[model samples]
Target: MSKSGNPTLIIASFFSIYVIWGSTYLLNKIAVTELPPFMLASIRFTTAGVLIFILAKFLGINLAISRKQFLNTVIAGFLFLTFGNGVVVWALRYVDSGFAALEISAQPLIVLLLMRILQGKKIKLMSMIGVILGIIGVYLLVSQKAIINQENSIAGMIMIFMCMLSWAYGSLFVSKADLPSNYFVNTGYQMVTGGILLLLTSFIFGETWTSPMVWSTPVQYTMILLIVFGSIVAFTSFNYLLKVVSPEKVATSTYVNPIIALTLGWYFLNENITVQSMIAAVVLLTGVYFINTKKKLLIFSRFSGRLSKKLK
Candidate 1:
C-alpha cells in the first residue's frame, strides 16, 4: 500500500478498525451466551488463521519464519490472544459488553505503569496526569452499584484486569521481538498458535463442543462476523492504516472503540449505560488522549503502535 493511498480507502480502513473492532465486544457477548468462551474463540480464530494463510499464499506472501520467531509468536499468541482475548470472552458471561469495553479503555494507563515498573521508564508530566485521571475513571467505572451487584462481576472485572496486564506486556514484548516481517504473516501465526492454545484450554476445562449446525442462527451469524470481519478484515485494515497513515491517526480507534461498543451493547443487548459510565468514558478517553500526546521521550506511543495491532 502506498503512503498516499486513495482517500476513500483510508476512510474505509478507519471505519473498519473503529466500528468493526468495537462491535466485536458485542459479537463475543452474543456468542458466549450460547457457546463456551474458549471454544467459541478457538473456532473463530482457528478458522480465521487458516483463511489468512490461504489469502497470504494467494497474494504470494512468504510464510516462512525462524524457529526463534515461531517461539516468539507462540508466546505472543498466548499472551495477546489466548489469554488476553479468550479470557475476556469468558468474562463477558458476567460483565456487560459495554462495561467490559469501558474498563479495557484504561489499557494505555496500564501499559504506562508497566513500562515504569518493568523498564524503569520515566513517565512524562502529561502522562502522569493521564495516569491520575485514568485511576479515577477506573474507580468510577468499577465501583458502580449496578455493575458490582451482578453475580461474578467482581471476578470478571479482576480477570479482565489481568488480561490487560497480559496485553500490556505483550505490547512491550512485540516491540522488541523478532517476528515475521509481513504483518499478515505475523498475525496468521499468532492467531493459529493462539487458537490452538484456546482449543487445548477448552478441552482442559471440559467445555462442551457442538457443531455449528446446532447453534442458534444469531450465534452462527455472530461467529461468521467475528471470524471474517473481527479477526481478518479489521486486522488487515489496521496494518494498512499503520503503513499509509501516522500511528497517531490510526490510534484514534483507542478512543472510538469503547464508545461504539457501549452504544451497540446498549442498543442491542439493552445493557444499562448509567450517567457515571458516560462520565467515566469521557474522563478515561481524555486520559488516553493525554497519554498519547506526541513527545520526544514518549515510550507509550512506541509500544502503542505495536499494541494496537492485536487490540480488537
Candidate 2:
C-alpha cells in the first residue's frame, strides 16, 4: 500500500471530513443572513476553485485530463455542487437550519438505494437494514419538535430534498465516471465548473445585491471559516477519502454530518435539542455502522480464505 493508505492518514482524512463538513451547515446558516444564498454559494465555490487551481499549478501538477473525463467531471460537478449544495443555500432562506439539515441527512440512505437501482450493485442485507433504520431515524429526528414544522414553507422542504437527491446521484456518478487521475486537478475542475453553474443560475433567477459586501461580525467570521476550512480543507479531504476508501464507506460521512450540525447549531445559535434528536442520531449511526461493517467484513473473510488455501 502507498504511504497515503496508512491508517493514520486515513483516520485523519475521516476526522477532517467529519469536523469540517459538519461545521459547514452552521457557517452556511450564518452566511445566508448577509449574503443571498445563491450568491454566497457561488462566491464561496469560486474562491475555492481558483485557489485550488493555482495551488495545483504551482505544485507542477498536469491537469490536462481527456475530453471524455472533462465532460464527466463537469456533469459530476453540476450535480453535486450546483444542485446539491446550491439548493441547500437557497432552502435555508425559508427553512430553519436544523430542519434543512434533517432533510440533507437522508443522502446516504438515498445513495444506497440509488446504487442498487442505477448501478445494479447488490445491496447487502446488513446495509439494507441500515437503510431501513436510517429511514426510521430520520423520521424520529425530523419529527422531534416537528423538526420540519409544517409552517416551514413546503417549497423549501422540497428544494432541500432535491438537494439530497442531487448529491446522491452525483456521488453515484463519481463512482462510475472516468475522472481525472489526480485528485487536486479533478477537484479544481469540479469546483470551478460547479461554481460557475451556480453563479449562472443565480443570475438567471435575478438574485443580486445593490450593496457592496456587508456582513454581521459573526457572519464575517463564518464566511472566512467556510472559505478556508469548509471549501478547501473539507472538500479536499472528501476527495482524498473517495480515493482511498470504498465509496459507500466514504459516504458514511453523510450520516455523521447531521450530528455535527446539531451540536454546532445548539452551541452557536442556541437551537434546542430534544429527546428525539438523541434517539435519531443513535439510530442513524447504528445503521451506518451496520451497513459498512458487514460488507467490509465479508470482503476481508473472502480474501483470508483465498490466502489460506494458497498457503496450504
Q: How does each model score on lDDT? A: 0.87, 0.78
TM-score of each: 0.87, 0.86
The numbered model that scores best in TM-score is 1
The ten-residue window of minimal lDDT in model 2 covers: 144-153
Q: What does candidate 1's lDDT look like per residue over 11-88, in tens digits?
A: 989999889989999999999999999999999988998999999999999899999999998998899789999999
TM-score of 1: 0.87
Stretches of model 1 off by over 4 angstroms after superposition = 1-15, 237-252, 295-312
lDDT tens digits by residue: candidate 2, 120-159: 9888767888889888887776565454554655678778
Looking at model 1, the pairs that clash are: none
> Which segments of model 2 are wrong by more than 4 Å?
1-6, 144-150, 210-213, 295-312
Clashing pairs in 2: none
Clashes of each: 0, 0
The root-mean-square deviation over C-alpha atoms between each candidate and the true structure, in angstroms, is 7.9, 5.1
